[model samples]
Target: MCPPGTMRNSTGATGIHQCEPCTGGHYCEGYGNTEPTGLCDPGYYCPANRSVSSPQPGDLKCPKGHYCLEGTVEPYPCDTGTYQPNEGRTDCIPCQAGFYCESALEPDPQPCPPYHYCPEATMYPIPCPNGTFTYDNETGLASEGECQPCISGAYCRGGYIMDACAGGYFCLSGSYEYTPAGDPPPANPDQDPCTPNTQCAGPCPAGHYCPVGIEDPIACPNHTIRNTTGASQLSDCRPCPAGSHCLQGDPVEYECPVGYYCEEGMPPEECPLYTYRNTPGAASEGDCYPCRAGYWCNDTGMVTFNQNPCPVGHYCERATPYPEPCTGGRMSTETGRRSNEDCPLCTPGYYCPNDTINVHGIPCRPTYECPEGASLEVVCRPGAYCEGVTGVPPDCPGGYYCPLGSSSYTRCFFPKYCPVEVKCLWNVRLDTWRCHILD
Candidate 1:
């Protein structure tokens, strides 16, 4: 019999003349046989003839980037869009999703690059279209649907880069070129052919502002106004001026109302307490004047001073916080006293203490005299008499004499008879009385 590794083609041939090694890509395991036992297994190659002395002599694993099949003599290269990263591969692997294998005999597939996408079994990455973009770091995209469209208020020409519209301009979606306000149609339409989907538009209109990449102009807020055109930022709107007020988006200011004052950019405020403003267009608190003398403005936002005059017996000064009573021996019978001087003194024959319009003065006492405007009563002098009904004192009577602080007269005796009834004289040095004889 031939050696285990050798094979015999003719049956029962002479000793070893017809015996030969197993054919390439085949194996012989048992003792002598007419033909090879079996072909090489898949994922393996048989490069040289096999011998029984050495087991499976030419059998080898397929190399990287190649594949092998049963009965194969040499390894085959992987086709395009397929790869073999490991040895002993029976079949090439199709490229994975989001990856590409561009050429044959590739060991591994490549991830899709930025701005490009790939599908399974793809040989090359596909680029994203214009007016769309992808981030530079974004890779391994799976399909064309993975690409992004350009955002509104911005533009993307190509290459996955987005740019904002310039100041004083606006942009819409899918914009490529900058646009401006178009001239009136039919007159000069060619000069400004305002195209849709343009990156930028008009310098903004009056009372409105437009920021970069904005789709439309924004109106000025309340308490602010604008007059000129081409406003690009919110700061272009000016505050309402003093002495005037502005509503939202107002181009002109309105005058301040009567009894109120308006400051810049502020709401109208009523005039302060104890103050008034009769006219419109008051700019600040200073424009609200204090109530004049002899007047009392008790509430806020008074428009007239004459409506509330100072009451009787009370004095009021300019800008007085409250009314003052007439006191200190002074009184007033009338209304609207401006100052202490305006309150008159008490009347004659009466002593006024804390007098008012309703209550005049107290009567004089019998033993005392009270002159005009007297705050207190005065005692009668020697040789004089006073009556409680009158405010003045009188001399002694013809038949009577008076002493100090006397309210009535005393009668003369027969021994001290009066010589002159009106003038009775006494001599202190002689200690005797001398008078003219009575008629």
Candidate 2:
């Protein structure tokens, strides 16, 4: 009910108004259409009228600014969310920033809490949370830490810093491994984890190698040897040569027979004798096969087998002689040829009397030489080399046993068979005694 002059009755006739209807921007609203003061003030939100209570004289009240009292008549106090200008308000402010105000809707405004801000389109922004961050402050006026971004290899969940990546993974200076906010790797410097066949303190021993990035050394191929005590490189296993023996305790050094060289784990054998390997396993000591029968061990002293034999047509001439490379030539039989054995006698039919061994088909003294006095009357023994010419008198091959004053020959044990018609002219028939030709 309005007190007098303020819509005193239900009729709300012009007598109810306290002032002119249209003056001071007023419009009326009520069942008693006669209310003078049209509507409430611009900033005011009062309820419909006469019979309704009014605010304190010349004043309107509402919430928004801790004003309107509970159950204050609508015309007296403004609606829930809006405000009035007059003082002496009762109800606390309805709601503001981070909160909302609804009409007499089913759900009421959910007020905002600290750390929680209202996003542009949201009734209220959810808490930025512990791991998240944003830019806007001012208690959630706009976008906040939620927009903060993280780098590659990093896990930026909400807004706070994400877990870091380790070294070799995080990008470094725009590298693939780099990641902002990445975790660092454990520090252990052994080697470069990238390249191969390269080492820091040189490579490990033979039969052993260390891979890059590995903590320790690695094994090598079988049959290979290693330098265990920090060697720069490894060596290969080797076999012993001729005349040399190699075993566990043997030194790496090996030897060969004098004038020879050992080979294939066997005893020494001839070399290109005159041109042998003077030093065992010398870098250039590859020469090993003995010289051909023509060459000689220019190096003195027997390592005899290692030396070459006299060449055809040539002779060694003397014992204990320093050998020389043989020069080519021809030799004759009449005299004993030179030989390593001091001009040893030549084959029965081919004599070489000089200090040499080469004896060609030159005729031997078949007609005259005799064990006793070789005279016209004497002859070779049976079974002896009868190198005599037909009708010749007593010269015969060696080993013949001519009887005294005779020209026939005699046979001997272990001797070559005498040719037919080539009889030993030991006792007689010296002139007819002759060796048979294969013809």
Best by TM-score: 1
Q: What 10-residue stretch in candidate 1 is worst by lDDT?
A: 180-189
lDDT measured at residue 354 in model 1 versus the true structure, 0 to 100: 53
Over 277-396, each residue of candidate 1 has an lDDT whose tens digit, in order, gives 999899999999899999888888888877788887688899888878766566677777899778787666667665443235677778777776777777876566876744777877
User: How does each model score on lDDT?
Assistant: 0.71, 0.36
Please state every model's RMSD to the true fold in angstroms.
12.9, 19.5
Candidate that would win on lDDT: 1
lDDT of 2 by residue, 1-439 (tens): 3343233224434543433222222334343334544433433334434232232334444433334333333433334543333354553343344553433121344544344544432433465443233433424333443233333233333343335433223211111211223332111224323222111122232234333222333333322333332222223333443445344322333444445555554444545424544444322235443333334545532344334555454544433144321121224322222443332333333333334334442333554332321112234333333444312334333544343233355653344445443434323556443434323
lDDT of 2: 0.36
TM-score list, all predictions: 0.43, 0.22
Q: What is the lDDT of candidate 1?
A: 0.71
Candidate 2: stretches off by over 4 Å: 1-36, 49-59, 65-123, 126-141, 144-146, 151-153, 161-439
